[model samples]
Target: MADLPRILVITDRTQVRTTVENVVRAVCKEAGCTWVLLRDRDLPPLERRRMAQRLREVTNECKAKLSISSDAQLAADVGAEGVHLQRVSDIDGVRALLPKGWIGVSAHSVAEVRLAKEEGADYVTLSPIFPTESKPGYGPPLGLETIREASAIGIPIFALGGITPRSGFSCVEAGAYGFAVMGTVMRASSPGKVIRDYAAAFATSSSRA
Candidate 1:
């Protein structure tokens, strides 16, 4: 529930142009990404844990926060800054598992956002504000209205999906706390630039608000 950075870089193994670890290293080296989530859901637990360990080192070297998606045990084992939940059913159980960890969850609808708030999610990412290549077939784009609606519910709502510096400010204006992105950062030749651009936009928009 502490102040999370305005820019969050979500790492997906399947979406990277190069190796996942290399992408993380390059992005962090660029110096704009404040938090990075290791979110490869298909990898076996051992492999995921290994990748998380490597990412933790990268985050440490860059003085950035690192989190593992959907694996509280591994997050605790790796001493991550936090754990994000995608499919966890019981927040109470997760809270017990991660007593001191920062928590975030994915919310698709306003109802889900309220549920997440009740369940004690520190933040929630409301997705598909625009069409996103990283996540296809999940559903149609939720649009900026989802962010606007969720913002009224009180949890810090992060807009995810097809976010860019130009479009990011629209999300902030619509009342999102920040942005979470994957494909844009993953496929970028200069991920640092992308992050810096988005961060700048967020700062300017937040100031105006």
Candidate 2:
């Protein structure tokens, strides 16, 4: 596996007024984002595939990797770099589909993170680290302590949920390998600037470490 990106951009089409491709391109080109996870799973299969294809083209031009969210077959069909699984049940299935590609999962606890690692997932987004509108129904926030424990399990943990440029450094101090963002970037008026801020945060964190 290549060195994972310090910031993972999760897409939510509903949060943005413009097209996802434009946002992704801006972030990739300006913010220097190297990875994007396409998460518009509510779309019809054909539409999702088409969007994935378009995103793949856009990401390619920006020298970034595109990973389909929770759809291994579609990811394979589109030649994506990987797939981000929503549940552990899909790990084994996805492995067979993208043998050499990255496989990540969404985990909410230490046990779940352990399970993902044991199942051969390359990494995980341990989410809800802070209260956020993005996933309000995901129960209470897991908090930074969860990242402290989950990172010890040996998987590269990306702290998700309510992570912003200001709060992202705290996650790194707590032992997160990286952090993921959805609404923050997707809903930003200047998505590229947001990405640039995240990159700066990570750089500062790395230096202090």
Per-model TM-score, in order, reads 0.94, 0.97
| lDDT computed for candidate 1 | 0.83
Lowest lDDT sum, 10 consecutive residues, model 2, at: 1-10
Model 1 residue 140 distance off true place after TM-score fit, in angstroms: 1.6
lDDT of 1 at 6: 74
Q: What pairs collide in candidate 2?
A: none
Predicted candidate 2 versus true structure: per-residue lDDT over 1-209, tens digit per residue:
34888789989999986989889999999878999999998999999999999999999999999899989999999899999998988888888899988999989889999999889899999988999998888868999889999989998999999898989989999999989999999998899999898877778987986
After superposition on all C-alphas, the RMSD of every candidate to the true structure, in Å, is 1.5, 1.0
Runs in model 2 with CA error above 4 Å?
none
Best by lDDT: 2
Instruction: Please give the clash total of every predicted structure, in order.
Output: 0, 0
lDDT for each residue of candidate 1 in 1-209, tens digit (9 for 90 to 100): 44788778888777677777777777778755768888887898888888888999888988888877888888889989788897537567777877877788988888888988987888888887888777777778888888888899998898998888899999999999888988988888777777778888767885886
Clashing residue pairs, backbone N/CA/C < 3 A, model 1: none
